[model samples]
Target: VNPVDRWDGTPLADAVRAGHRQVVEMLSAAGAELKLDVSQTSVKLCDKAREGSVEGVRLLLDGSADVNAADYDGRTCLHLASATGNLMMTRELLKAKANVNSVDRWGGTPLADAVREGHSSVAKALLEHEARLEFDEVKTSSELCECARQGDINGLTMLLTAGADPNACDYDKRTCLHLAASVGNVAVVKRLLEHKAIVGAKDRWGGTPLADAVREGHEQVSELLLAAGATLDFSAERDARELCESARLGDIEGVKLLLAGKCAVNATDYDGRTCLHLAAATGNLVMAKELVAHGAGVSITDRWGGTPLSDAVHGGHFEVAMELRKHGAELKYSRLKTAGELCELARVGDTNLIRTMLAVGAEVDASDYDGRTCLMVACATGNMHVVQVLLDAKADPSVKDRWGATALADAVREGHAHVAKMLLAVGASIDLEPSEVVSRLCDYAGAGQLEHLELLLNCKADVDAADYDKRTALHVAASAGHLHIVEHLVSRGCRVDAVDRWGGTALSDAQREGFTHVCKFLEGRRQLVVLKRSSSQEQLNLK
Candidate 1:
């Protein structure tokens, strides 16, 4: 009478599925234990529970069916009832002594599902049953570093109070303390220090929290870190950047301070635009003359190949442009060029103009001094038609720019999967060095660049590749609170338990940072990894 069937369930479960209440009770009384696999269990039980079939559930429970017996996904009837907000079913399951804290495959507890689904009745009842909705599950401990980075003190406090580790470092080897200090969050620093976060912890680049504060010129944060015993090894770089801004704003006094501090008068900003360029562009004749007198080069070209005189002329500062000429700049070289026009057209997806240029014998592979071809420009902008035109005209997709970036790299970096596919079809190289692969993986994962991650995977990059800090792309995605990217990496079989140099796994990092969802996913994957290892050990032992 208790024999199992093809559906992997006993006669009582089959009778329950058939909805024969009399037969179900008859089978229950005849000693049938209600057991089932995924198909018969989660589906049938979920339907019965959601429909408030109290008698059916009671029949199974009274027939000695384990109330806590879960499906393959570890989902008990209680989880389903709580998720669907079926308070009636939840009460029935609870009355049968359901394990309220049972974690499903997705890391959902009955209370968590109840709370997430907004069934306060079920949630309160579960709480009364000794179910603790831990803050890690509720607030997503994966966001702790983000909270600290954003200066969300209340959120940080909640995460810390909920048991997130203060010293938990990210995939980049940076802790929440590092993020707070870098952003000049004095109150966050205080809270982190109170939690005993490592005062002198260094990042992957060996930059301490104090070093970050000092580099960003946050004097207050620097002072706080120093008081908490952090050391600094660099200064004056921020002032150099400030010099360019001061020159543009015509802050002559600030420029004087930078000059007095022996800052390089010719120091260029990130875009290779110097103080002379800014001063000239803003038509600040006094600032321009001061920079020129202090040895600013008028002939130096910026990233766009524009000289200071060119910037002044373009901005209608003819007077400043004339002054720059007097300051050892000779010719007003015309920035207008046919090749420049073609590249510009490609950038804006002007396919007809590009076609006309190509028809008129223009160099299809014409590049600027930076080695940026028209194809590279088109690919970076995801101009698929323009890229196709350039490709048909024999434009080299494999050409690398001055920064070693090819069309494929540019498309991937910008999340242009279609462009990357075209480049790949044309044999554009994905032959990156190990370091390049690691950099791309971490950068792409942290930025949530799914296209870039996919392109890297297509290139056969190692799913478990670690950076210098021993942190994988999975770790980076987890700490960034990017659950989608984290899931993608795990789907590709990344090691969830792969430990970083900070001795933190992806799950631990997510938990530390307040990404409870990421933690949940990683925790489930970790159990699978452990199970596989144990199975392998068993096989080896038998051998």
Candidate 2:
């Protein structure tokens, strides 16, 4: 007679549902207890609360029914009362000391459901009963986001007033401010901002409130965020390499977000291309102007020396070229295609591009803004066929870069000995003096480029060449603890006793820097060799 239905409702629940007082009393008297836990049901409490039956809930509470018992889905009596906007039953449950913050399976608290269901009075009552919007950050953030996304200002206010975090974020770190700004909810945004919500908080994907506002064309929201001291997010922008790609794809909206986030106006990729370069190549004149207005230099060059101006001209964007010239970009290169274009083609290792550009009357011997020639670019990248083609076209190999590095010097510096030999065959100059010695040997040794060091020495570069402080390759090698380069330099007859301006030899440098192996080798070798060279065999014999 007391069997439960498939919905977890017993005969007592049916009696209560139909308001049959005599049967409810008879069922209770016939051993029908209302208390049930997790897997079963908080059936009597939930049904009474859902029907706003204050007396039914009171009878159960007086019958020793557990006030905090929840159903299988974790929906407690308080959750049902609050969700149905039943203030009387909610207050009755609160009077019985109900768990106001009980979470349902969907992570909804009583206050959260009340707020989301537009039950302002019930939410207020729940808040007055000290109903926490969230005891869990994940659970609470979801409720806050629900209120914000629906533009329910009253519920949002109650949550915030009850000490809910203004910047509650979901799993993706998408904050309520991001949602509010994106939806153009000005009043909700104002309410959140009043609670001190971060105007430029970035999510997991680097999406910020202000960026969201701008991307969604919410001008007023954007202005509000900007007025709140929202600027670039350099930390997020560094890891986000999306700006260059956005510019290339003509995604101006995404560019606005990335540009606002990425502080560097001239930020470049691994290919050394900037947003301006991408915009010019794609003929996005509007994006180019935006970049220029934000202090992007039109004369900025890529790894192959391709500038925004030259890229614009090469792409036949005459309007973009004219616009670039107005921003102090000079058309300094000769002919139809710029020298930077030729240098870029040479760097690509495409022999056909070189021939085609050259056939179009492109200047071969001219230098780009970086003062690097096509032949130098070709030799630096070790593009054999491109180098041969340029050499055959009478491209001058003698031109030095801005760093005063000839094509041969560039080749040798990059360890391209084969290309260096080719440049030498064309009468390219080589100077293994102080500049070359310091740049090539010391740099290679300090960077632990033992192969480059061996190549330089094999090319007959001065073994003991030193810089201004008289710091040689051995000094840098020892200081940097490159034991292999130190041993190789010692084998090549570089003097260990040669002193710097500080009067410290390579041995002392190694010892001071705590290089045990280098110190041991130098200490053992020092005892075998004379400190100062003897001018004559008689002087050596006397020593």
Question: Tell me, what's the RMSD of every candidate?
Answer: 34.2, 16.5
* Candidate 2 local lDDT, residue 23: 73
Index of the highest-TM-score prediction? 2
lDDT of 2 at 499: 95
lDDT of 2 by residue, 1-543 (tens): 557677766676666556676777777877885434433348767888888888878766654478888887888889998889888888888888998888888777998778767787888888887777664666567777887789989878877876788777789998889889888899999999999998878888777887667656577888888898886454424423456666777878767765665557687777787888888888899999988988888887787777887677677676777788788775345532466678888888867656645554467887877788888889889888888899989988778778777787777778887787787776766654567666678889999998788867766788898888898999999999999999999999998888999999999999999999999998877876753443455587888
Q: Which stretches of candidate 1 lie over 4 Å from their true place?
A: 1-32, 43-142, 149-155, 161-163, 178-187, 199-223, 230-232, 235-543
What lDDT does candidate 1 reach at residue 491?
84
**Per-model TM values vs. the true structure:** 0.38, 0.47
